[model samples]
Target: MAGAAPILETRDLTIRFGGHVAVDGVSCAFERGTLTAIVGPNGAGKTTYFNLISGQLRASAGAVLLKGAPITRLAAPARARLGLGRAFQLTNLFPNLNVLENVRLAVQARAGTGLDFLSMAARRRDLAARAEACLARVRLAERAHASAAALSHGDQRKLEVAILLALEPDIFMFDEPTAGMSVDEVPVILDLIEAIKREGDKTVLLVEHKMDVVRRLADRVIVLHNGALVADGEPAAVVASPIVQEAYLGIRTAP
Candidate 1:
């Protein structure tokens, strides 16, 4: 088990917009079964880095490898098919569909069944059952019949996670997973992430601004500044480092 290759990796990954280099040449590897939290000041390119890796933004330079194979040219949907799942800062769902249908579609997609919803529903009861299980995991079973547009923002976020679960990817990338949720709604997502970590198979990459959440969930922490990887280590060590204290946490000790 020791020395297995990392499930996901970025090799000097970078991207630029005209004159600005949003994500500089940053490289890192993520081993399976570990949760790495990416933290930085606003505009430090954390989300941009995630976008490059997840194929939302193509890299201007460098390579992205999944299990050591280059996938830098792949599109977002291509990356998703190859086991990269991403949950965005804003909820992405079918506003017109009911809660259950949204997840059922994800299940159907993962099963390689065409999206003939009516036909699939008639032929495959297992898809619906699997979707229900994903919803229950996110505490949304009772709202299964509710329209996605009708649910509150917090519930919508939960439904997004359920959809991601239904896809069953090997790598889970969550960008600000708790950004807009109420305090009461934060724990459900956190608990679900903790459960994923407990599974000890899926690799998770989280981009978060909440220090408390990072402290509680990250197995390791990586700090970025000015579009570069500034620090990488255990949570306590990274958080306590002088660079992070001053730049990220806004703690300035006397020179």
Candidate 2:
């Protein structure tokens, strides 16, 4: 990761939906090759912030920068080409496609090659190899041929992550990667996140509701309340802060 700059930054970012503010004057940086988490309660503007950063929703005000250059004007695919990737809280896989083909399409999309027919998609040798690598990274190699709809909720989440990984992004933004997973699936999702941080050269920004996962994986934690950042710091310190506790826990008496 040498010579790599900060992959993403938001300067005084703000967003609105028909006169209602969703993210207000938020500013943060996601550095290259690190894992960070965003934690907040419902309507805390987590997903809205993600949408602004990933180019799905345009910011009403402020700048989104990639490598210190303004990217606020870029579209989602344009941002992806600049090495930004995102996974949704809701599963965003192609239900009709089998696992390999799903991932292969992502790889092909990122590679910017001309489209291939399904019959010849398997023969595109390089795309299949890259797709297999991504699936293997997420421990989904055994399920490569299964229809995506046939996989469990957890496997679908992993597949989503794997598909994004195939993009070879410098920054990976995950919105609640474990949203609908069972208890047993939590560790698998966590392990995949850990592996991305450990082995991939990607900077990760996760917005998660689960405090346990937030505590375990986050290098820095940012807490949002009422569309504003209320806490940002090392995970333990941020969690223990009175502001964070009050904002999310509603604790009034001294414990």
The candidate that wins on lDDT is 1
Runs in model 1 lying further than 4 Å from the true structure: 115-123
Q: Which pairs of residues have clashing backbones in candidate 1?
A: none
My TM-score estimates for the predictions, one after another, are 0.95, 0.92
RMSD over all Cα atoms, model 2: 2.6
- In TM-score terms, candidate 1 sits at 0.95
lDDT by residue for model 1 over 1-255, one digit each (tens)? 358778988999999999999999999999999999999999999989989998999999999999989999999988999999988878889999999999998898899887565563745789999999999999999999999999999999999999999999999999888888999989999999999999999999999999899999999999999899999999999998999998897889789
Deviation of model 1 at 103, angstroms: 0.9
Task: Give the least accurate 10-residue stretch of model 2, judged by summed lDDT.
Answer: 113-122
Summarize candidate 2's per-residue lDDT along 164-186 as a digit string, tens digits. Answer: 88987888899999898888867
Top TM-score model: 1
